[model samples]
Target: MPQSETLRAQAAPPRLRWWTELPLILLVYACYSAGRLLARDDVTTAVDHGLAILRIEKSLHLNAEHPLNRLFTQEAWLGVPADFWYASLHYLITPALLVWLFRSRAVRYRAARTWLMTSTFLGLIGFTLLPTCPPRLLDAGHGFVDTMAQYSAYGWWGGEASAPRGMGNLTNQYAAMPSLHVGWALWCGVMLWRFGGTRLAKTAGVVYPLVTTIVVMGTANHYFLDAAAGAAVMGVGLLLTPLMLRAADRVRGSFALRSGRSPEASPVRSPQVSKGPRASIVSGGCQTSAGERFPRQRESALPTGAGPDASPADTGDGAPAAAR
Candidate 1:
């Protein structure tokens, strides 16, 4: 194989274990949550950014959020379900797809997981740089309703974002520029469409992300621009995943070197031999018993009175005599 092909084969997905994967996933999620909390900006600035986005959307004739938000707000059936979808699916479906990939399509799991994590961190950077508020967080004068708050009585979430009732403060409500709900949904959709192996999965792949984009907007949790940004973030993450995997491999190689082992080392093997008895060649057309130095000259062939110390001439076999 070519060197590139050899490296590719060597870098194939390794066997996964729940014990290790669970901790890694939890760590990334913890970082994601903590990052949101740490990247929070003041309300005034976030609201200004939100207003700016709305103005831009209006200018571009892409203010789809208004109609959808109004519909979702006026119809309780739509609003309540939209709220549930916005709050629950964002947390549930991403992890469920991850578990599914790990179990059934492990070959693609690592890249998909890496892409998600990379995009999440990138979203964190956006949250820090531009902490834009969601449409629902804007003043009522702006004509958007907080569906989660409106439908709070029906579910475990509170008015503040998607956290359970009293735990609302635990989440950051201003990180709305790049909607990871949409980004993660896109990731899940791609995974299902590419590796799902069934028509139902492929159909769900197309529908899930499309519905999530609408759900986020309809519930007033994200703007059209925010959904677009989320997808852009995922695209950037996909581009960076190969570099990330290569960097990880280098780190692993360095660790192996530090531990005095080569990552590419092959096992040592012994030479094979048959189990049958063996013989040693003494001379042309002659063999000797195992461990014997040479074929002994027959008594009749031996010169008369010649002893064991006789030279090759006396033996007449032309074999060299034993060393003195």
Candidate 2:
């Protein structure tokens, strides 16, 4: 039968093609959102992700007075409008990326979403647990001052605690431990490098990662350590990605197995019946296979030497009777 007719023979079919991972994605999203909300509830909040970083930072004496720290800790000499660049970037870039992905392939879209969200979620958890304030939030004269908050020009939203939390706030604020800004930007670069447009895409693939790392550290959104942690998270996330999809596939296959069903066992072939010569008995030996078998003696019209007990006539008579 034709393939078209064979497809029609199915009693039921999958409603969505390769949608097995959707449920798991949704579940992860729910847990992540809940964790973000818990930051407000100090008692239940898991703020270690960020606190852990702060503890290490203090141990290494890399606070405000540290030379590398002071570079980023210093007020933005480029002017306060830089916050406009930073704040606007966080708001606009990811969503725009996601939108572009919606028009692209589903695997890439999902992968991008996973990388972005996972990085953000881990950052948020750090924020709640660690809560190391940004340089701008520092009150001491030596520590970094909250330039965006202090400079009202384009940093209107900087340090504005009153902004209502929404579904968009799936990440934490004070968890600058592992800056998702840097991590997610790197994720974008990786996605583009792995699956982007053209020559320019390839160039961006090379440049974006380095540029993003510099921006985050120079701007004080992340420290060198923070950027390193972000990259680590991305690496781990990408490595575990195959496990997620494979797990979903196995679940479906398990269900099929339970019902004594599987990819139709390649139709069993019937054993072919041979139509060759039949076996025959020979002097002192027998044949039971395909090829003809002969005894260890030569054939002759007359016996080469008749036994003492039997004459040539007797042997001839015996051969004629056997032939019969």
Candidate 3:
């Protein structure tokens, strides 16, 4: 078989253990969160950045959040549900979809996971570079309501970005440019639409991200442009997935080589007896019935008392000689 095919045939399938993935995912998220914290600017800086973005939106005539925010806040019933969806779905749905993919769609799970992770990392970089505030955190003069704070008495989340009371400091409120909420929601939708077993599943995937985008905007947690940037990041990540997988494979192969591990054990050495009237060639040394032992041959070596050009098995005796 060809060497590449041999290596591929011997390669093991990817492992999808929850116990391993859970910790790794948590660690990556923790690092992302911690990095956001370190990158956070003062409230004034964040708010100023947000205002600048809002101005740009106005210039582009794309400030959809104005009407959406007003409409959602005017109706208490609508606002409450939007708040819940914004806070809960991003955390709940994405992970559930990922777990489902890992368990049921093992073949596709790696690409999906890599895409999600890459997009998340890109979002983190955006957070570090442009620490813009979400609409909810802006000054009250801007007319943006803190919907979660308004419904704080109903849910476990405190007023600050759906985090638990007093623990809100652990979260970076300024990481708002490339909202992971919309990014992850869109990722879940894409994966489901692409891999779902049924039409309903695919339709749900399409509807879920759309709903998530509306919820984020209506709840004042993210601006319309933030959602766009989030989807853009996801698109970039998807585009880079093939390259990332190839790089990962190369790194794995290099590591295996450095560790002196072969993909499979060496082929077993067996004795080969010539069917023609010549001596047999045993890969490893073997003994004859006459109690004589023969060692393995070096290509340059000649038999004892034989000329340099003598045939290896030209002895007059009929008995075949062992590989010397």
Candidate 4:
């Protein structure tokens, strides 16, 4: 193969294995959670950032959080379901879609997985750089209600965040500059639309992200600008995916080299011919000629003083005796 073809083959997406993929997904999630925790800045700073975003949105007339939040809060029917969607679907749907792609559409799984993970890490970076508080976490005067808190009795989450009743402290509420919920929903949407091959899946691809955007806003978990930034992050990640896959291939290749093997190396060795002479015996007591040619057999010198008609000693069954 040409050098370019060899590199392309090496860089192709590897076969999926649940044993390896599960651990990797868990590790990335853990890192994302830890990053959110570590990026928790002081409440005063976070509030200031939130207010600045609010001012910018107001200037641009994009302050959709307040009205949607009011609508969710005023109606129990909408509030409860939106709260559940915000807390549960973000965790459930993304992984379910990933498994779907891994099992049913494996050819596209690696690139899709890489895109999601890259966007998630980029969101983490945004959190670390700008720890803006969610609209619900703002002062009561801001007119934003935390639907999750209001509908706490209807679900398993507590007032602090989407985490379970007592585990809210484990999560960072201030890391809301870029909403991963929206980004992940967009990822799932794209995956479903591109590879689903069904009418229902395609419809879901359109509805899931659109509804997720509304849910995040209505629940006051993210600002309009934060959702926009989430989308931008996904865009950047998509653009970087090819480079990321290439880098991963390089790393894997380096490890293979360290382990004393090349991925393209063949395991079978070539056949070798022996230089020593080989012995042959004629069947039915037939005697061999002095200078007969045999395939791949080197001629041997006859014993000293042996006549041309001399025959080698034979064992039973017409076998030739071993040379002394």
Per-model lDDT? 0.82, 0.53, 0.78, 0.83
Q: Write the per-residue lDDT of candidate 2 for residues 14-111, one digit (tens) a residue.
A: 22333554565566657655564555434223244334545677898755323433453455554344445555664565566666665675546765
Q: Which prediction has more favorable TM-score, 1 or 3?
A: 1
Over 4 Å off, model 3: 2-13, 263-324
Model 1 C-alpha lDDT per residue in residues 142-205, reported as the tens digit of each score: 9999888989999998888889989988888998989999999999899889998999999999
Q: What is the TM-score of each predicted model, taking all chains together?
A: 0.79, 0.56, 0.78, 0.79
> What is the lDDT, from 0 to 100, of the residue 215 in candidate 4?
92
Q: Positional deviation of 288 in candidate 4, in angstroms?
A: 38
RMSD to the true structure for each prediction, in A, is: 9.7, 13.3, 7.4, 10.1
lDDT score for residue 322 of model 2: 23
Per-residue alpha-carbon lDDT of candidate 4 for residues 1-324, written as tens digits (9 for 90 to 100) = 333444454244455799999999999999899999975757888899999999999899887888899999999999999999988998999999999989988888899999999999999998888889999988899898888998999999988899999998899999898989999999999998998899999999999999999999999999999999988999999999999998987887788889996644323332232333322334322334543434444334544665554455321233433433
- Residue 84 lDDT in candidate 1: 88
How far off is residue 161 in model 1, in Å? 1.1
Task: Give the lowest summed-lDDT range of ten residues in model 2.
Answer: 315-324
